[model samples]
Target: MQNKKLNIAFFGSSLVSAYWNGAATYYRGIVRALHNRGHQVTFYEPDAYQRQENRDIPDPEYAKVVVYPATQEAVYQMLEDAASADVVVKASGVGVFDELLEAEVLKLQSQNCLVIFWDVDAPATLDRVENDPADPFRAHVPQYDLILTYGGGDPVINAYAKLVAKKCVPIYNALDTATHYPVAPEERFQCDLAFLGNRLPDREARVEQFFLDVATKLPEQQFIIGGSGWGDKPMSANVNYIGHVYTKEHNAFNCTPKAVLNISRESMARYGFSPATRVFEAAGASACIITDYWEGIDFFFEPETEILVAKDGAEVAELLQGLTPERAKAIGEAAYKKVLAQHTYGHRADELEQLLLTTPRTATAAPSSADAFVS
Candidate 1:
């Protein structure tokens, strides 16, 4: 495969470490991988809060950070910066100025640039578009050259197809091995089972169903929960809640726990193949993972070998009680090996490059005309 060195401009919520959003890690991982492959990347972040609180990761060495204002001037500036880039990616869920950013990115298509609508939350986005046909983004989807999602399998592809996207690809969440690896166990995070995920409305119920229920059932065992929006929840004495853990502390949290729990959001579990970034991160750190049952498990890992699938709180209890330390370590090792082999950002970047190469590119970008080609 011929490697093309493309100038890519990436627009997303916030890269500033202070914001501490999970997408920051996603951007850093993929952007760094693209840079390693010799692509020039420029990242645009318009969220002032993220810029103010940015502490997620250090400024990426491989990419240039362009902090744009959350104003009309910022959109104009973004247009000027993105005009000459071969590819301009607008990632979904950028906290601030995304509506404005999306409008500007759509306008850039007429400049003959390859624009990609990269959705991190495919389920949410699809749901929103389905409920409202007159959404501004709905009309723009067909105009964009490609649609990429962070996770979701067939459901996401089908959703994009409904929007008349010329091509849609699911670039599933992957681990950055360099950032996540086995570490010396820490006493603070020691527990029989642990789960790390930010609290979101769609995921809150699953967290209750999988983690909280499991904690309630296994009152004798120590359980630790990490992530934001979990502070107000009443946790059992056995359940230790650590509000929000930073990325750098991820490995210690993974290594300290005997077994880590993976509770997929309602939509992701239903869709299958929708492994969150935490799955790969835990695997990369060689943490034994017991995940809730979802579709397409075989494609990622073999049940009973590389991973343990749980149906509900009772199943989670069964695993917690039965899984010995040695067996847990072996499972973690197996998962680690599997991830290193097939689920790394490097691998995802390769897949993305292939998709981009195979897709037809056009020099003209008139919105109505572009829609005709995509449809």
Candidate 2:
């Protein structure tokens, strides 16, 4: 079975839309890469969260997508079809019926099938279980055949180990070369520095400290902030709020900026080794990237050369003050080459393929109707 082309069933937020789904890029990249490597993938997503109505792309040829209703019956119907799949993935944060899905996916586990709990936001999940002893998911963690995380290095792996997980691995985010690459600069996105991330509780304060604070220091420089939920937030006049940019415009968004910014969520920054998908996206677009300091960034790109690192808003201001277009281009080129060579989704897919083949399956017997979830 080492080289077997297994069938993979992915239960995620949405594969065809990114309206409010932050993990859409990560799903598209890895799934497309896996398809290219000859595996058959079937992505199942709930129709909740208005994702179907606001789809960014039609059904992709790479994976067969099944968009079911948000009702409990719909998940059960989907699980019946997923039972025989070689691998079944229940991702974190499906928006609706998440707890139901989390418990139900494990019922498909058997010697012939691998059931995985793929956490797109491992930092937040770990924080929750660590703080709450009665967290329901804590009991379910050790039962899965394998645990895969979006991007947490040692901190995440060890945390799972403490929960007695059979095996836990990190499948860090990566660039999709086909979808994210250099493009002609767009007038609307052109700015001194740009940041694109949805508004979230853990990230708001950091954004203030990094992007908004830096903008205050450089009153003359132009800045643009894109994403949902910042339409009314007060900010420096020099900073423009572009609001929710589509993925199709991502390359231009990154390329047009003199330098793009990346601010990790509070948990991710404290944990280290978690690089946001935007880091690779900007690097793939050959945009000079200025990111707030976090542990393990150097593991991805050489700082001060391939990528610029800043300790705080003051340091970010200083970096921007010194950055010239020519120097920015040189740094962008270096980053583009590095990511293409080592950090594309193809590379990540290869690692995942190996893990799937090597990780020993230690799941319990198939669940009975008596163990059915109560929703």
**Global lDDT of each model?**
0.82, 0.91
Residue pair clashes in candidate 2: none
Best by TM-score: 2
Collision count of model 1: 7
Model 1, 149-193: lDDT tens per residue?
Answer: 987788789979988998889988888877899999999999999
How many clashes (backbone N, Cα, C below 3 Å) per candidate?
A: 7, 0
| Per-residue lDDT of model 2, residues 1-375, tens digit only | 888998999999999998888899999999999999999999999988778888889999999999999888888888887887889999998887888888888888877788899999999999999999999999999988899999889999999999998889999999999899999999999899999999999999999999999898899999999998899889999999988888899999999989999999999999889999999999999999998888999999999889999988889999999999999999999999999999999999999998777666655676654454333
Task: Give the least accurate 10-residue stretch of model 1, judged by summed lDDT.
Answer: 366-375
